[model samples]
Target: MLKKLVLIGGGHSHALVLRLFGNKPLSGVRLALITPDIYTPYSGMLPGHIAGFYSYSQCDIDLQSLSNFAHAQLCLDHVIGLDLKNRKVLCANQPTVDFDILSINISSTPTKLSVPGAVEYTIAAKPVAQFLEHWYQLQENAVRNPQKALNIAIVGGGDVELALSILAGVRKLEIYLFQSSKELMPSHHQSVRRIMRDILSNQDVKLHLGERVCEVVKLINKGLTIKCESGLMVTCDQVFWVTHASAGSWLKAAGIGTDDQGFILVNDNLQSVTHPHIFAAGDIAKMINYQLPKAGVFAVHKGNPLYENLRSMILGESLKPYKPQTAYFSLIVTGDGRVLANRAILPLPSHQLWWCWKDCIDRNFMAQSPHQ
Candidate 1:
């Protein structure tokens, strides 16, 4: 009997695994993929897509086509639960699948905060598909009401929030970026953070730093109003929340060893501590040996390592450790065909040429995928 290899989610890591498995098939292994969407969106190209630099087709990885090439079964459904004891994965619209080995590359979802009305009114920017749809509607509304001044609030302190702001620059919309921290891009170095702040300042984007959002309430005349902990109420046409990326609720319920934030705890081999037969990658896996930022780049890099480990497990070979580099280059698009490259402390100015370079890189990644 062929050993069943089940992969949950069509994320970047899993996509690479499929490609690798396609090129180098493992004996007696039957591959399967479960995901809600056929096409997985690339986060790296999302900013460019939002900024009108690339089309939707240019950034999506087609899972159905990739699965065909890899000789894997594609289950187009959402994984609602996992039966770890039985080594079975429960789907929303499909029958449960039993697996000999399992891997997960599902991305994180925006965590619900203590703030009131945030869950009901604010739009989350993690589930890229839903966010993209909402953003498109907002763009359409703005185009129809070109004369009216629009007020948009992006609640986050990460690079994603900045990217959204840059993308929203297509319209003459009045954008406000609210960060609870004293500075933006809190994870970045001071110099890089300063440069980002300067970029936002130059763009005339309003910044409300050091003010935590306590609640969000929809006003009859003023769309959505966010009440800050500092006793300030901010009214905006729409609210975009890019804060807090948490793992799928199913992971916790499945009794997987997870952190407080719900990210699955995985060893260097990317296998769950409690369930060695089960593997995890992308934003869902927390590196046990090395701590790394939840960047798409890391997820992309994990593809090869995961592929090797999965093959090793099938062949009774020893697994290899996935050591992440301390620092990686970060390119920030400022929404005007300009990008900033942050290698270390200070970010180097990357003009149109850099944007073009980034565009080429993203396009190539999408093109290499079988789905594309």
Candidate 2:
């Protein structure tokens, strides 16, 4: 009997897996990819895209054509839940998909709806499609009214500096960045944080550190109001929620092993702790032994190991355990063609040469897909 392999979400890891499987096929195994979008954006180039450096087609991967190349059934639907006992994958718009083995690569999203009026008034950064739609519309509005003053608020301390710089390019724009913690990027070294802080200050972007947002209100004058737990209020033309990472509640509800934050708990082999037949990768998974940053670089690095282990299991071979690197190089764009290079083990200085290096890396990764 032929076994079925189902891949959920065309994230960076899954995209590489599909490309590899296309080159080497396993006999008596059926493969299928269920994703919400036909073209998935590469997260690495997202900031550049927002900065107007890359076009939509330049940063997006053509998943439809990639799936066709891999000879996998492409089911474009939103997954709602999973039927683990019966080995069925439940979706929002299609019938239950049966699978002998399943791999989940769906990335995470910000904690939306946690604050009042957030869902209605603020924009969540994940589901890149939705955010892009609003961003493109805002750009159009800015173009139409070149002299209008805009107040933009970003409610997160993530690497949104590039996004802030892009907003600052607008004439008569006031940009505010709100962070709950006293410092930004608590994970990085103090020197790195200082560099970012100085850049934002020089750009005239207001910093609201240590302020936890409690509510977002829609004003009657076609604007928005943000209220912080510290009793501070600010009005802005638009609010973008780039808050902490959060996974789907359905994972915990369905009895899958998940961390406190709802990310799937997996072993070193990237197999679910509770379900060995199921694997997870990318931002949606948390390793039991090593805590990995939910970044695109780690996700991309796990691709080869995940592919090898998945192929090993399918061939009745022993699975290989892999450990993620403790230290990695991080290049962050400054939204004006400059980049900041940081190595957790040894922090590097910020320079424009790093931006050229990052562009080459991103373009090479995107060039892997022949259809892209």
Candidate 3:
């Protein structure tokens, strides 16, 4: 009897899994992929793309080609829910896909848009495809009305701030960053934070520290007013929410074991806690034994182990545990022709050479696809 293996979301881990499966096909196992888009953008090159250093085709993987190479049926649809009891995957537009084994590698979106008018006013810097639409429009507006000064307000103190700052510089727009915390990038080392602060400062971007947004009010003139808890209000033409990552609500609704934030709870082998037949990786998964940041590099690294375990499960073989490295090297593009290199709590100097290194690494990863 043949078993169906369904992979959801064309994320980095799933992309790698598809490539690996294509190279080493398994007999009697049919594969299918469910995703919303035919092109999956590489997070590493996103800033470069925004800065006009890379084109859209250069930064995104051709999922259609990759799926064809893997000999898997590509179902382009947005997943709405899962029929866990029936071992079926539900979609927004397509019919339910049945699978003996399933894996989810979907990305997360900002869910803290609880404030009034926030959802209607702010653009979440996730579901990258959607954001790119607004981004392109913003660029056009900037070019069309160069004299009118475009003001952009981004909420979040994470690595996103750095990339947005680069965009602000490239577009020559007035940018403001609002962070609830007093300091930026709490996960990074003091040195890295200091460097980021210095870089953002050099970019002439305004910073609003320790100011928690209370409400987002749309103005009659189609502008936005960001009111903070501290009674501070700032008016801007656009607001970008780049805050915390939240999993899809369908995970919780499907009765899957998830973290408090609704991210799937997975073991060392990347198998779902409640259902061994189901596996999860990438930002949507929360490792129960290890707390990992929702970073794409980690998801990319999980590809190998996840593929092995999935193949082993299909073959009725033993599964292997995947222990993430205690530390991984991080390269942050400085928006200019420079990059910042760091590892865990250690920070290195920023230089243009680092940018070259990062560009090479990102290109190599993209080149792994069947046809670039």
Candidate 4:
């Protein structure tokens, strides 16, 4: 009998695994993919999409097509919960699935930081589908109501916050970036930080640093008012929350050995610490040896190792460890064909040609059909 391999979430890592495993058949292994959407958006190109640099069709990976090529069954349903003890995966609409091996690659969600109205008023940036939909609606509204001043507040300090800055260029909106940390892009070098700050300044984007949001209140006539710990209040039409990315709630309920933040804990082999039959990759998997950033590049890089490990586990062979790179290139577009490149140093000046280079890279990445 063929071993059943069920993959939950069509995230970058799992998508690569699907493609690799499908292309070179994993001996006697059957594949199944469960995800909420058929198309998975590439995060690296999202800023470009928001900046009008790329179309939606250019950034999305058609999971259906990939699955068809992989000969994998695609289940378009949300995995609400899991019964780890029973070795069954629970879903919102479809029947539970039994598997000989399992892998999780679901992306994270924004942290519900207990700030009073954030849950009700602020929009999370992690759920790509919902955020993309909201972005389109915001753009439509902006075009329809050109006279109204669009005051938007981005609550976070990370690469996503930088991406949001690029998005501001396309909109006639007054943007404010709120960061509880003293420095933006805390993980990046000072030079890169200065460059980003200069970019935001040039764009007329306000930065509220070292201030924590105490409460978020929705006003009746006005929009949303965010009260900070410093006794300052900011009123905005829309709030974008891009904070710490938390793992899927289903993983926690499923008794996975996850961190307090809900990210699944995995060994170097990408096997779950708690469940030997299970594996994890992408943002959902936390490396025990090294702390890797939850970037798409890391996930994409994990594809080969995960594929090998899965095959090894099935073939009763020893698993291999996955080592992450210490540094990788970071290219950020400024919406108007200008870009900032950072790897070892701060943001280096990148002009339209750099943007074109970045565009080519992203397009090439998206063009690689996992199915083929």
Candidate 5:
């Protein structure tokens, strides 16, 4: 019988895996893809998409056509639970899927903070599809009430800097950004963070540094407010939540070895430490041996090795390990057509030229994707 290979999630890594599988066939193996979304949004261009630089379709990679090329079954359903013993994947809207080898590339969840009234008050800036839908509606409302003062609060660090710029620039709204740390983008170079901090300050963004949000509550008057541990309280028309990035709770609940944040624990080979037959990639996974940031670039890097290892496992061959590079070139696209390129040691100016380069890189990535 042909070995069953089931891929979960249509994330950046899995897109490349499917493309590679489509480019080359593995005999005696049947492939299947289970994802809730038919189109996977490329995180690289997501900022551009939000800034009105790229259309939605331009940034979203079509999985349907790619699956067809790979001769893989595309089950458009959300994987709610996993059955490790039976080697089955439970879906929300479809029948159970059986697999011999399973690879998960599901992107991480936006946040796990269970702040009171968050569900009713705040909008998640992740699970991209939902964010798009909510943002579009909010944008429309903002347009309709152009005279109304639009006050918004974003709960996150420098990761939300791009979104903050867009919200301030595009809508000309009063934006408040709250971070738990004294400095933003602590993982990044000081110059990069300094530049962004300066930009936000000059652009009239209210930066609440070192203030951690404790509780979110809807006011009786008309708006929502969040109280910080530092005793700062602000009422806003909308609260955009981008603070944390955790993994699917199902992985940890199913007894898979995971980090404290619920990201699947895997070796350098991308194979689960506890279950060798299962592999994980993208933001949903944590390399036990290395500290890899949850970046889309890493997900893009893991694709080739993940594909090769999956193929090798079926043939009973030795699996190759993937050691991620410590630092990567990061280009932050400021909403107003400026790009900040971080090369660790280089103190480069944020320029439109960099924006051109970033656009070319992003457009090229989308152009090379599997499409019919």
Candidate 6:
């Protein structure tokens, strides 16, 4: 009997797996990919795309062609739940998909809050697809009404500096960033954080640190009002939520073994601790022994190991363990052809040379697709 292998999301890891499988096929193994978007945008270049440095087509991974090359059915639907006991996959549009092996690479989302108009007014900026859609529409609105006072609010800390710097180029609008903590990018080097803070202030980007938004009220014919728990109110044209990262809500309800944050718990082999038949990678998974920060580079590197382990598991062979590196270089686009990078305690100041290096890396990584 042929074995069924279903990949839940077209994330970086799964995309790499598809490319590898396209080159080498495991006998009697049927593969399929389930994702909501036909083109999964690469996070490495997403900030550039939003900043207007890169075009939409440049940063997006062509999932359709990749699936075709891998000889996998690309199911254009959202995975709503899983029938774990029956070893079946549940989706929003398609019928139940039964699989011998399942690998989930779905990325995490911001923990949805129950603010006044948050559900209706705020946009969660993870999972990439929805944020892209939301930005496009908002950009159009801003372009059409040049005379309208435009105020954009982003609620999140750390690395969001990259986003705010680039988003300043998106339009001639007042951009505000709010972090609940007193300090931004707390994990980063103090010098690097100070440099970013200076850059934002110099760019006229309003900074509201230590103010956590508790509610959002959509003003009729005006804009949206954001109320912070710190007794502050600000109205903006759009509110983007990039709060704490949390995985799919359905994972817990479906009885999947996940961490406190709702990410699937997997062993070093990337197999679920409780259910060996299920595997997870990327931001959607957490390693039981050593946890990896939610980074695209880690996901990119996990591709080969995940493919090897999957092949090993299906063939009744010993599964090789995948040990993620303790540290990796970080390339952050500053939205103006300059980049800031750091690896471990070493930090590189903002410079165009770093930007060139980052652009080269991103382009090279994106250029590998057989068809993109």
Which of the numbered candidates is closest to the native, going by highest TM-score?
Answer: 3
Higher-lDDT candidate among 2 and 6? 2
Our model 3 lands, by Cα RMSD against the true structure, at 1.3
lDDT for predicted candidate 6 compared with the true structure = 0.85
Best by lDDT: 3
Model 5: per-residue Cα lDDT over 182-293, one tens digit each: 9887778788788888877777888898988988888888788889988899998788888778887788988889989999999989999999999999989989899877
The weakest ten consecutive residues by lDDT in model 4 span 160-169
Give the 10-residue window scoring lowest on summed lDDT in candidate 3.
Answer: 161-170
lDDT of 6 by residue, 317-365 (tens): 9999998888878776677778888887777877999988889988998
Q: Write the per-residue lDDT of candidate 4 for residues 335-368, one digit (tens) a residue.
A: 6766778888746775787777778887887777
TM-score for every candidate vs. truth? Answer: 0.96, 0.97, 0.97, 0.95, 0.96, 0.96
Each candidate structure's count of clashing pairs: 0, 0, 0, 0, 0, 0
Model 1 worst lDDT window (10 residues): 160-169
Local distance difference test scores for all models: 0.84, 0.87, 0.88, 0.83, 0.85, 0.85
Clashes of 4: 0
Candidate 2: misplaced stretches above 4 Å? 168-171
What tens digits encode model 3's per-residue C-alpha lDDT throughout 1-372?
898999999999999999999999889999999999999899998888888888899999889999999999999999999898899999999789999999999989987658787789999888989988888888888888878877788888785534553464446577889889998887888899898898888777788989999899999999999999999999999998888889888989999999888999999999999999999999999999998888889999999999999999999999999999988898877778778899977788888999899999999999889983
Error of 1 at 163 (Å): 4.9
lDDT value, candidate 4, whole model = 0.83
Which parts of model 1 are misplaced by more than 4 Å?
A: 160-169
Q: Tell me the alpha-carbon RMSD of every candidate.
A: 1.5, 1.4, 1.3, 1.7, 1.5, 1.5
Q: List the residue pairs that clash in candidate 5.
A: none
lDDT, model 3, position 358: 90
